[model samples]
Target: YSIFMCLLMSCISGIGRATALALARCGANVTAVTRTQTDLDSLVQECPSISPVCVDLADWDATDAALQNIGTIDLLVNNAARTSLQPFLEVTQDQFDQTFSVNVKSVLHVSQIVARGMKARGSGGSIVNVSSQASQCALRDHAVYCASKGAVDTLTKVMALELGPFQIRVNAVNPTVVMTEMGHLAWSDPEKSKKMTSRIPLGRFAEVEDVVNTILFLLSDKSNMINGITLPVDGGFLAC
Candidate 1:
């Protein structure tokens, strides 16, 4: 059984690395997709068990071809995304275009490609799209990012409904201020981190493990009855 882990940018580090290790520990062969060959090499070194595929998700044709060669993914985790923080007034069209293309279109394209193989396999497979609390909530300087993720949240339900006949489950895991390397950069300052954490009932930033655990549950048979849902692993941030 093979699992395709679609990670962008720095896959060798951060939440991607942690998730790769988690899958490897389960004896599932992981196929990691990223933009840089150097980073792919590092991923191979870090998780010797993983198969690295260097590709730019922004390039639709390349992404499709890459998945075609891999063939029959039992599990697909679409976690590749980029966030741009700019005030509404200052945001450029290029920024909005790139954010939506990467965050929304990429996920749609990969899911469609992989779902075909899963349907042919008969028994079916599962997909977990990485969403964000920003999808449903308003945040400063995140107009484009929030809009893109909001589309993802809606798409998750649509895919679940359409793919349910094939027994292929589709779901999303939404996190709030997760402490990934990239996330740390966004809220690195102690004061900024504190202000964000204070809003969460849990009083802490979301850990990678928290989101990963939720995705693992959805991927596992335990969530068999669960579909078309965006479960927030956001430390009750959404509730508040």
Candidate 2:
């Protein structure tokens, strides 16, 4: 039973934690990455099978060092994104930069680093970038967040095309609002939750399992032919 190093940029909570547990359940030795050592420690206990690594994905040197420690990765999940919800007029330069730095640049750094090892071994791998349904549809007060994810969706296609020759498949999973710890905080108010749920044709936010199943499919050989596509696990949010 050979181990697969699952490169996860998001660590302790939210979708990242779900992804870590999902990969571990599938028998992969997950190398979870995060900014805070405290968060990493929590993750280590949350998903005991996963090996947590503390690294600021936005920092080039730190990310590079973290990847070096992993040596080789069988699959890279670019699931690190920061969302800033504000009206277009109220957006700041710092917000724009931070969103791009994490959502876009960090994906580049991790993918490039992991691809080298995957390519050198002549045994290709898979990359699953976590995009947002906002990339496919418009929402109020999500300009910067949308743009950042839009870039991720585009980057997924580009990587798929470029890495195809090496047999490495790249795909994006665009999920709608997931019911995580963060979701409770974000949509705590009943009015907001109800309004948001009504927008989805399914009348509910996505569950951790919804996105996790889709991610596992993309990572597995089951989706070998499915490349360069943004599979929206949005529960009919994009349809309506």
Candidate 3:
């Protein structure tokens, strides 16, 4: 199957890179979309099988045009997002717009584009939106981030309801404090890390592979019946 994945930030690191490599290893032809040529080069170096497309998802028009070129894909993963950690009152208009544009609007636009192709092909397809645990629970300094993810959760349900007749499965994966480079730096403080991990029954942050595995499952036929749910890969943080 052909897989199309969008990773807004650096393509060489984080969930996007891991997902691309994993999918390629599974023998699926993977097309990775990102914003930087440098990161695209790095991703190609890491996995020569991945086809890289450079397009800024923040630009709706450009993203739409780029999606048209990708043709029809069997699977789509909207993993691109912009996060701003600031007090609700301190968030600037630009910051809010930027965050929503990348996190929410892009998902809507890209999914529409891809879903149309899926419908045209007369075959089923899977879409996975990378969400966050912040959507369901409150977190300090995550007002906008939480709000964006909340929108994603709602969108997933609506999309599933509308697209299920066409044999399209839509779902979201909500992960908490994944141990990416940025994740480790953000929670590097011993006190903060301990306090956060203490709340999770697993007592540890998630690794990229954890998120990748869940995504793979959701994309695969194993989750054929699952639709419109935001499955949490949060190390049981929400259980507390």
Candidate 4:
């Protein structure tokens, strides 16, 4: 079976990179849409299954045009986002707009473009939006990031509700701090890391494979009846 997976990930970062590479290794054709080609240099060379498309998700027309002719998409991961670490009072208008544009707007726009294909062709598909626990729990300086992910969770439900008739499944994966380069950089501080990990029963951050495996499952036929739910891969953090 031909599997077309679209990963509109967070600027070629940990979860996106790991998921794309894993999918490629599994022999799935991947279309990785990024805002810049510079971030995808090594990834493209390493994975022959990935076809990189640099389209600014902040621009609606550009996103539509870029993904329009990508053929049928059987799986879609709306991992697009721009995180801004600023206090409530310190967040700027530009930062808020840019964050929402990439985080929330892009997720909706890109899903629409891909879902049309899945719907028109009468092929059932799965869409997994990469979300976070921050959507449910507020972080110190993640006011905007948390809000955007919350929006994603809501969107997942709406998509699941409307697309169920067409055999389309929509869901979200909310993971805890993952140990990617970016994750390590952000949580490298011992005090900060401990503070966060202490809250998680797993007592540590997640590896990239943890989230990737979840995404792969959600996209496969194994999850045929699962829809409109936010699955947390936080190593039991959310359970606490």
Top lDDT model: 3
Q: List clashing residue pairs in candidate 4.
A: none
Model 4 misplacement above 4 A:
1-13
Give per-residue lDDT, candidate 1, residue 93.
Answer: 91
Per-residue lDDT of 1-240 in model 4, one digit per residue for the tens?
345444445435688888888877888888887877776666787775688888788899987788778886888888777787999999899998998888888888888988898899998788889999889888998999999899989989999999999999999999999898889998999998999999998789999989989999998899999999999988788887
Segments in model 3 whose C-alpha atoms lie over 4 Å from true places: none
By TM-score, the better pick of 1 and 3 is: 3
Q: Which clashing pairs does model 2 show? A: none
**What does candidate 2 score on TM?**
0.93
C-alpha lDDT of all candidate models, in order: 0.88, 0.82, 0.92, 0.84
- Candidate 3: tens digits of C-alpha lDDT, residues 1-240: 999887886775799888999999999999999899999999999889899989999899898787787876999999999887898779888888999999999999989999999999889899999999999999888888999999999999999999999999999999998988888888999998999899899899999999999999999999999999999999899877
lDDT of 2 by residue, 124-184 (tens): 9988898999897878899999999999999999999999999999999999988888787
Stretch of 10 with least lDDT, candidate 3: 4-13
Look at candidate 3 and give me any clashing residue pairs.
Answer: none
TM-score to true structure, per model: 0.96, 0.93, 0.98, 0.95
Deviation from truth (RMSD, Å), model 2 = 1.9
TM-score of 1: 0.96
Q: Ranking under lDDT, best-scoring first?
A: 3, 1, 4, 2
Query: Candidate 1 — what's its lDDT?
Result: 0.88
Q: Write the per-residue lDDT of candidate 1 for residues 1-240, one digit (tens) a residue.
A: 688898885875677777877988889889888888998898788778899888889899988787787866999999889987999999999999899889999999989888988998897889999998999999999999999999999999999999999999999989888788778787989988888889899899888888778888899889999999999888898999
